[model samples]
Target: MLIDFLEFMISASNDSYIFLAGISAVIGAILPLSTIIFANFYEKSTVQTNDLYWELKREVNNSKAFIEGFNKIIYLGDNREIFNSTLKLFKLISYILILLWVLVGVGYIANVSKKPLDSFIISCSTLALISLLIYLPRILSRFQRELPIKVENKSCSINEIYNIFDVKGKGEDKLFYEEILVPTLSIVNTNSKLFIRYNQNLPLNNYKVFYSIQNKNKERLFINIGLLIKNKDFKNIHYTIGNEVSNTDTVQNKFSSIPFGIISKFNEIDSKNSFIYILDSLNQILYTGEVKCIFNSETKISKYTIKTYIDKSPNGHISKLLQNNEKEVHLLDDQQKLTPYYLLDYN
Candidate 1:
């Protein structure tokens, strides 16, 4: 009876030991198995992220390059109509391609044969990525890249610009001398020769006279020109403050007041031409050997005088010119000479 009990106890102990060993082995395997699964998830996620980044970057660059190239064609070739048509074609194609990509990616993700939870995760992620893919091109169209996309234009040739800068008139008449004030301060023709200056006591060579004008055909923003002497040129200019304003009504807070008239240095041009000018808002003809001229540009202030020849006046009277309250008005006698006193200011 004792021997039977001992055998039974030994068998029970052995079974218990086996059960404990099996439980310990399963516990040990649980951690490694979980670790392996997590590692695989991380690897897959990393790959997806990398691919997404690269793909987005590539698409962005390609879109910008395409647009930039198209603009170059318009600018350099003067083929703006053709450029717009071609670019519109590409824009349509890209739009169609993006729509198709979204449809496929979304449809596959929604109905694919996979675990419901996994499908949900992948669907959300891919939808986000694909949605970005769909909108990325549109957004990238607005995005300016760091890389400079230079497009040269079919601009007015240097020769043409130079010739215009020479200030030709109805004939090849000489138009300048010492000092000239802006009539209205409008830059009508950038292609033509223009100069704006405040003839202060600065070295002629060192002082940079800043001015700007727009292209008549293009109507671009005001582009600045550097200091030009009797023979100089400017290009690749930037925006800066000046003594004058732009072609538009937006006034420059600095140096707002423009001179009422202009005085020229050339005597020969004055005697020969029937040109009239302003001095302190006074309309005076080029009657003297010292040419007194009125400067004219597109930019107009509140009240001002224009520079041109008016054949009606036998002698352009300085006193008749009254641009604004800023100037004292002078009148003319029946004899067409300067009145003894200014008409408006004597009182």
Candidate 2:
């Protein structure tokens, strides 16, 4: 009886091993095929993303060219419509592509070969979700575009102003005037060497400052003042100013000092308000301030400007200030004021 029981146990063990081997063989075959399918889907999604990206780029270049040609401002409205539409589509597609790849990774971890029917259902559901996401944004963007948007040319008053100067001669015969926009109203003496410390809370590192001068005739001149970058330690910020002649042109006279008046006409704009427009690389205005000349006995010695701009636009803080508007918008609570210190005193 003991010999018969042992023989029965051995047969059961052999049957179990055979069943396990069959399962493994099925899994091994299914996994490779599933992997190939996922890989193909990933490759297609990547190709679609690349194609959309290039299309978006082409649209941007066309819009830029239209603006540079000084075409009617109405054409700009049309370009914006196209740009927003393309951008929304591009974003949605990119997000769905990422999600699809993540789903493929999850399938491998979840042992999807064991449940082929469930895996197929999941893939179909993912594709449906991607389609829905891509379609919804288009429908919404179109609806929004068709709706009339009343954009008010709102003007805001400056909460604080800072007077910064670099004086060489006594009072009137100063050759150059440099204006530095700080968050705080700290008095900087040109005679003494001081380290200008920016407020850490101020979003200067993300923006590029442009010195804009408009003459009495309303002709505007824009200068790329400088951009503030974080130091290696990320504790302090440094200013890097350069003048770009054109898209393909480069100048050798890259100086650290903010060139207030490279053109003599820039100094002659005493009758009009000189504006310091803070913008990102995309030409979106983040802040706007007026540069007022301080005349001492009919000699323009110093200049001062307000430190903030209107935060009305959706993409940026401010768009533009209405000319001669009495309505005043207050400064945002989150805006930080800058403080300047002596360079030797900085730790």
Per-residue lDDT of candidate 2, residues 90-172 (tens digit): 45544645454344434432543357776676567556656654564454344233211111111101110111122212222
Name the top lDDT candidate: 2
Q: What stretches of model 1 exceed 4 Å from their correct place? A: 1-76, 80-85, 88-96, 99-102, 105-256, 264-347
In candidate 1, which residue pairs get closer than 3 Å at backbone N, Cα or C atoms, i.e. clash? 164-193, 165-193, 184-299, 185-299, 186-298, 186-299, 319-330
| lDDT (tens digit, per residue) of candidate 1 on 118-221 | 76775576466456434634543332221111122332222221122343222222122112212222211133222232222111121122111112121112
Backbone clashes in each candidate structure, one number apiece?
7, 3
Question: Between which residue pairs do clashes occur in model 2?
Answer: 183-338, 184-338, 195-343
Query: Which candidate wins on TM-score?
Result: 2
lDDT for model 1 comes to 0.30
